[model samples]
Target chain A: MTRQELFEQIKIKQSFLCVGLDTDLNKIPSHLQKVADPIFEFNKQIIDQTADFAVAYKPNIAFYEALGPKGWESLQKTLDYIPKNIFSIADAKRGDIGNTSGLYAKAFFETMDFDSITVAPYMGIDSVSPFLSYENKWVILLALTSNEGSLDFQFSELKNGKPVYQEVLEKSSKWGNPDNMMYVVGATRGEKIGEVRKIVPEHFFLVPGVGAQGGSLEEVAKYGMNSRCGLLVNSSRGIIYAGKGTDFGTEARKEAKKLQGEMEVLLNQYCY
Target chain B: MTRQELFEQIKIKQSFLCVGLDTDLNKIPSHLQKVADPIFEFNKQIIDQTADFAVAYKPNIAFYEALGPKGWESLQKTLDYIPKNIFSIADAKRGDIGNTSGLYAKAFFETMDFDSITVAPYMGIDSVSPFLSYENKWVILLALTSNEGSLDFQFSELKNGKPVYQEVLEKSSKWGNPDNMMYVVGATRGEKIGEVRKIVPEHFFLVPGVGAQGGSLEEVAKYGMNSRCGLLVNSSRGIIYAGKGTDFGTEARKEAKKLQGEMEVLLNQYCY
Candidate 1:
């Protein structure tokens, strides 16, 4: 989807939320395990319950991959089931040399048809350029990730006195404009979000550390929000694993609704 | 497989050559396309013809994944068909948060039963620690890659006056001993391989870019070889796409034999 198109979805839904389907079979309700495709069934219900509050659904590819080919079948089904208006993200975190990266672009963009795939920037421009070549498909490059490991390499000081992550933002942001690219800026450090925003002021930031990871929604909005409501705050574990019972979808919806509520208030106030 | 087991295979085969199974359906011979599982059939024939010359087979995951679940099924078949003595590598280049990285480790290690998986180091310690926890399995972290994009960040000068890739070598080498960890030091720059070897003298280095990407095998052996033959030089297109006819496997075997022949001499000389 184009940047304008994605912003329109945010405007129409009054939510910039991207529900993460990091669905693990071990974590889902036991009763659903007997189903033909439990992972798909779980994701279908999650989308059904949370679709109203979310503009996108981010499926971390590792979850389904753990189950092998059968898992990929379920993932394809889940992608097919999502509403057309809602953007889909394959959080695959894939990057390689140019030719191999092209095949990955084909995998996510042509074969399974995701709107975007998260890319690791370690391989440099060739690894990223293949994904960016596709029109309307986004390359969400890993900048400052939400995990504790982000501090290890992302913060390494360059000779110019900027951290490695900032250098990633500066160089990679030029590879594609705001329309075809986005950055995964962790929400854990609100000040860091502001710092990243200063680097790529117009690009959409997929902030992933909001609910379960102890990142505050208020602070993310305060630091990161732009005129386009340029943020997709994700809450995976807290919402998807909200209730372990049969009515888990209801509980998941409740959690998503709460986040949507907070986002609504932020969109009105902080998003000038 | 343990480090000793891999080294023993290298000695037994008289080669440290790693055959990269970057099997693309589009690139395979026309005769194989009509088979029930063409990808697996092609791989089976290739393994049969070249197993004697290659000690390790590294399948680049993106090629199979581009074809979707059917691709993965073909991959499983290919993995199953390989000889037990040979080392198997899923060149998946995968890494995420701690929990998600654990799932990836499970996918490549337990679920699929790969001996090792190439992991990107951009996410750092926690992203790598999960893979290191697995006994006998290896995490070949990307240090300096062969592509032009390697220049983007891997060469960034850090506060300590060393390049980022060197820092990756220094910090991550301690994460796991030679038993479970290896670094992907590209053969494109022989001096860089020597630089990487200086930091992690004992850990194995999975060096790509030998033939097809224009890295000299002699230079790689000269710079990267350690006392234990700590190198797995990979060549995908040079060996796999060497022939495009019905006799492709025979042609591939000839290419593998040529590399193995060179490696035999190198092993006898430099690997003291």
Candidate 2:
């Protein structure tokens, strides 16, 4: 899906929240464990309960992958369960050779039906171009991440006088336009989001690390929000596994509503 | 698996070849298509025929993930089909937040049961350290990729007067010792392999871009080979889908043998 369509969905739903489906079998309540696919069951409930409050569902590939074959089946089911208007992301973080990446594009876009897939840009353009080739598909490339270790290489000053992450943002921008591409600038790096904004103000930013990761949503919105409300703030543990009991779905909805409410305030402040 | 164990496997097999199980459904013969899972079937046969000759089997995750839930199922079966002694890699190129990355560690190492997995170091230490937490498991960080676009950022000079690829190799080396870490230095970048070896002489290197990618194995071996035969030369399409007819397995085996034969000679010259 194009970025504009995603923006419209967010506006219509009055939410910019992307509920992360990092569902873990071990973390789910034991009551649901008896279900054939507990991961899918959990995802289904989460989607059903929180669909109205969330504009996107980001299913982390690793969680489903941990269950082996059964986990994958659950992931597919979860993707199918998500509403058509909501953006679905296979947070796979995949990138490889050109031919191999093309096959990956087919896997996520053509076969399983996800609107977007997160890609690691370390392999350079060839690995990312394959994903970009799909019409209307999005490539969320890693820029400045939230982790403390991000200071190691990403912030390292390059010979060209720019930091490594900035260089990646500048170079990768040429591969695809803002409509087909996005950058993952972690919300935890609130101070630096302004620096990131200067690089690509038009592209949407998939901002994670809010809530449970200690990133302030207020700070991220203040510094990172553009005219288009260019942010998809994700909160996995904070939203999905909020209550952890029989009323988990209700609690999830409440948590999503809280985030959406905050997002609405941000959107209004940014004149969206 | 530990680097010592991987080296022993190479010596026992008298080859440093790592057959890339990049099984593409479209590339497999029609006869295999009738199987329950064509990708898994092809991988099983390839593993069986080449297990005695190859030191490792690198399954690029894009290939498996492209098939969706079924592809992941095939990946699990292929992992099971590989001999216990040979090194197995889930080339997923994953790197994310610390907590999420910990789950990724569990997915590949604890759940899916791979000896190693490819990672993109662009996210820096937090993105990579979670993978290193797994004892004896390897994190094959992308160093120098073999693609035209690799020149975009990887070769851009860093403020430390080193290229970004060199900076990644140098910094990431501090996170894990050579025994638990490796870097992917593309085989096509033979000239720079010598430079990479200078920085990461102890860690093993997973070199792709051989065979179909037009990378010279001899040049790679000459410059990149370390004292322990520290190179996992991967040939994906050129070896796995050598022929498209019913004798695909036989053809695959023949193609793998040709690479192994060359690897055997390289091993002798370097190790002895």
Candidate 3:
């Protein structure tokens, strides 16, 4: 999706909520387990109910991959079911050498038709530059991830006094414009959102670590929002696994709506 | 495979050569295209020819993923065909949050039964630790890659005077022992191999960029080899796609045998 298109979705929906479809077969509603593909069935319901509130759907690829080829099929079905207007993210943290990365870009962007894919920036420019070649597809590079391991290498101090994540934000920004590039900034660190904005203010931030990960929507919007509503606060388990029963889909919609209601207020306060 | 089993394979074959199965459908000989599942057919022939010389078979996952579900089926057949004694590396640079990383571990290790998988270390400890839980499996972490982009972040200087890759080596070595952990050190920079050996002297290094990427096998063995002949020098295009003809399998075997011959001499000089 284009930058203007994404901004329009956020404005129209009154939320920058990107619902994470990190679907796990064991975690889905028990009643759906008997269906041909439980994960896809669960996702189909969730998307059907919550599409009104969510601006995007980010499928965590690892969950599908664990089930082997069957999992990939389920993912394809889920992707096909999601409305085109809602941005689709293949939250697969993939990057490799240039040629290999080209294949990955083909896998996620062309074959699967995802609007974007999360890419790890450790291998540098050639590893990431392939994804930027696709018009309207974004490469959401990993910056300050919410995981504890993010502290290991990403936050290491550079000689020039910038942390490695800052170096990533500064250097990688030159590779692609704001339209084709975004950064994955963990919402757990609200202040770091402001810190990341200082480096690249115009770029969107795909913020994970809200809800189940205990990040506040108010703090995230206060620090991370830009004029274009440059924050996609994601909630996976908190929203999708909210009440695993026959009415699981309805419960998920309720959870998404609650988050969206808050996001609407944040959008009015910060972006407007 | 255990570290001891790998070293034994190196000694038995008198070669530490790893053949990368980065099979690109477009690049393979046109004659093979007539066959059903040409990628797998090509890999089957190549594996049949070169299995005698190669200690490990590393399939670049992106190449298969680009083809979608059918490609994954080909990969499954190829994996099942590889000799049990020979180590298999899924050259899939995958890492995520802890729970998600566990699914990835199940995908590659438990489900696919790959002996090892290459993981990018940018996410830190939790993202890496899940892959270490499997017995006799390996987590070949990316240290120095053989791409131009390697210069971007892998070489970032830390305040303590060590490079970012060194910090990765020092910190990550604590997460898993040399038995279960190896590092992907690009053969492009021969001198960096020596520098890496200084930090973790006993660990095995999966060295890529030898033939196709202009890296010298002689220099890699000189500085990188340790008591166990600690290196798996990979040559993908150089060996697999040596000649695009009906006789491509024979040509691939010749290339692999030539590398294995050089590796035998290196073993005599360095390990024995």
Compare the candidates by lDDT and give the number of the best one: 3
Task: Give lDDT tens digits, candidate 3, residues B1-272.
Answer: 89999899998999999999999999999999999999999999999999999999999999999999898999999999999999999999999989999999999997799999999999999999999999999999999898999999888899998899999999999999999999999988889899999999999999999987999989999999998898999999999888889999999999999989999999999888
The predicted structure with the larger DockQ, 1 or 2, is 1
What are the per-residue Cα lDDT tens digits for candidate 2 across B135-201? 8898999999888778888888877688888888988999999989999998776789989999988
The TM-score of candidate 3 is: 0.99
Report, to 2 decimal places, the DockQ of model 3: 0.92
Please report how far candidate 3 places residue B144 from its true position, in Å.
Answer: 0.9
Q: What 10-residue stretch in candidate 3 chain B is worst by lDDT?
A: B153-162
For each candidate, what is the lDDT? 0.93, 0.86, 0.94
Candidate 1 C-alpha error for residue A240, in Å: 1.2
| CA error at residue A94 for candidate 3, angstroms | 0.3
Could you arrange the candidates by DockQ from highest to lowest? 3, 1, 2
Comparing 1 with 2 on lDDT, the higher-scoring candidate is: 1
| Candidate that beats the other on lDDT, 1 or 3, i.e. the better one | 3
Q: Label model 2 with its docking quality class.
A: medium
lDDT of 2 at A57: 92
Poorest 10 consecutive residues of model 1 chain B by lDDT? B166-175
